[model samples]
Target: MDYRQRRRIKVWGKAEYVEGDSALIERLRIPGYPAKVERAILFHVEALSENCSQHIPIRYSATEVEAMMAPLVARIEELEQKFVGE
Candidate 1:
């Protein structure tokens, strides 16, 4: 249709987690900025239910990465609401 309408996306993750002997030992990541933005957490754990941020990464700690991904994430969400009917 239009250029703007054609250029929208969704935030998807080829994400993963790394578990050790400890309770909080996993991660969630997405292609962020020009690199990968890593999020360490307990994503699917039930007993201690709900997601807990381990060491708690600042959402926009890396300036370059945050700057790059900020617009991308926003566009993706916008596209989701527009196209995916989310």
Candidate 2:
């Protein structure tokens, strides 16, 4: 989910607000295979400066991503509970 905040990301002499960023994973199953093939998707945040460009890929392993996202997820949940009065 993208947070609607006044955070700006600058690139190549131009600046743009951070639209959003999300993590995704891909898995595939093969015929007669005993296990599913899994892959971690690597992607760069895109921005339009002089032209459309991509930032450095988030090159993190699955475990690392989970560890990094935990606090953020908990914070979001806490905020949600507060907003809904739960």
Candidate 3:
């Protein structure tokens, strides 16, 4: 018999689009119309702890997801280019 622990991530709340999520958009320094960025949907990412089986929210914005992924996307592109000898 084997006992394994499973960890999961969950979105605690429904993603919502707010027309003026300026405070977050500004804080992230996302360049674009503040209102537009704010209008993007937002949600909470939660981590499930094995011991507690409770969802603990991780503070981050759904709007900034693109911004956060930019660097990784660039890196992947670079890697692909290198692999292709380009």
Candidate 4:
């Protein structure tokens, strides 16, 4: 999923805003797989979640395990941006 989001993504004139990031509607191309999987992810950071939901269940997705710490990431970035302007 992360690979699909980072490497290549396609949105058919539609997009979803998630976790301060744009979730581009994309389909994963897996050879030999008869199904085209649709997935999304956080671009700049990750998604943190203690309570599971439909979109994000389990602990984390591919790319990294600390994805469940998205809140922390956003907070850290927010503080950094506020303290240091770049």
Candidate 5:
């Protein structure tokens, strides 16, 4: 069976737009960049339903993903070393 099919989850909620706090906005602002987010949206969940996982995508842990990319990272490093030597 597909991975996503193993788990099904649904969430129902009400969305509310709240004014952003000045301190939070300032903290989130990047230096030298204009502020973009002026407000925040909050979701008040009313219900959660778990039906099926058929639509969910498979997810890997950090370690698992790192292992998968180890060969590529090693190849890049080897190429960098060769480039530096030439």
Candidate 6:
């Protein structure tokens, strides 16, 4: 089970090779941290599977959340202004 008690699948794989530094590796490297990815282990999947996402909650992007709250925020501001004026 996952953190949210959602069922998940396990996988079996083998380490294929150690990946060397490249453009993709450099892009993955985080700044200001002394630790760097000297090499990465590539995996060869023997078998893989996943369970249904029926238990997972829906997620929203920043723009979507802002758009959803805009009307409520405008109404709140309008009320605040009316009370201040009185």
lDDT for model 2 = 0.51
**Per-candidate clashes, comma-separated:** 0, 0, 0, 2, 8, 0
Tens digits of per-residue lDDT for model 6, 32-66: 77886776666788997787879666666789889
1 versus 4: better TM-score goes to: 1
Local accuracy of candidate 1 as per-residue lDDT tens digits, 1-86: 12222332233334345545233322333335465343353345334222334433444347768888989999999988898773
lDDT string for model 2 (1-46, tens) is 1122323345434343332232222223346776544543333546
How close is every model to the real structure, measured as TM-score? Answer: 0.25, 0.32, 0.31, 0.24, 0.39, 0.41
Model 2 lowest lDDT segment of ten = 19-28
Best by lDDT: 5
Clashing residue pairs in candidate 2, if any?
A: none
For model 6 the local lDDT of residue 36 reads: 69
Local distance difference test, each candidate: 0.48, 0.51, 0.58, 0.49, 0.78, 0.77
**Distance from true position, residue 58, model 4, in Å?**
12
Which ranges of candidate 3 are over 4 A from the true structure?
A: 1-54
Question: Which of the two candidates, 5 or 6, achieves a greater lDDT against the reference?
Answer: 5
Q: What is the lDDT of residue 60 in candidate 3?
A: 49
Q: Tens digit of lDDT per residue, candidate 5, span 1-86?
A: 33533675678999987675877667656788765778766689999988666567787778989999999999999999999999
Measured with C-alpha atoms, the lDDT of residue 15 in candidate 4 is 47
lDDT of 3 by residue, 1-86 (tens): 11122334333556766566677656756566444443456675554333333443344466677889999999999999999995
lDDT of 4 by residue, 36-65 (tens): 445544344334333323343243365565
- TM accuracy, model 6: 0.41
| C-alpha root-mean-square deviation, each candidate | 20.9, 18.9, 16.8, 20.8, 12.0, 9.3
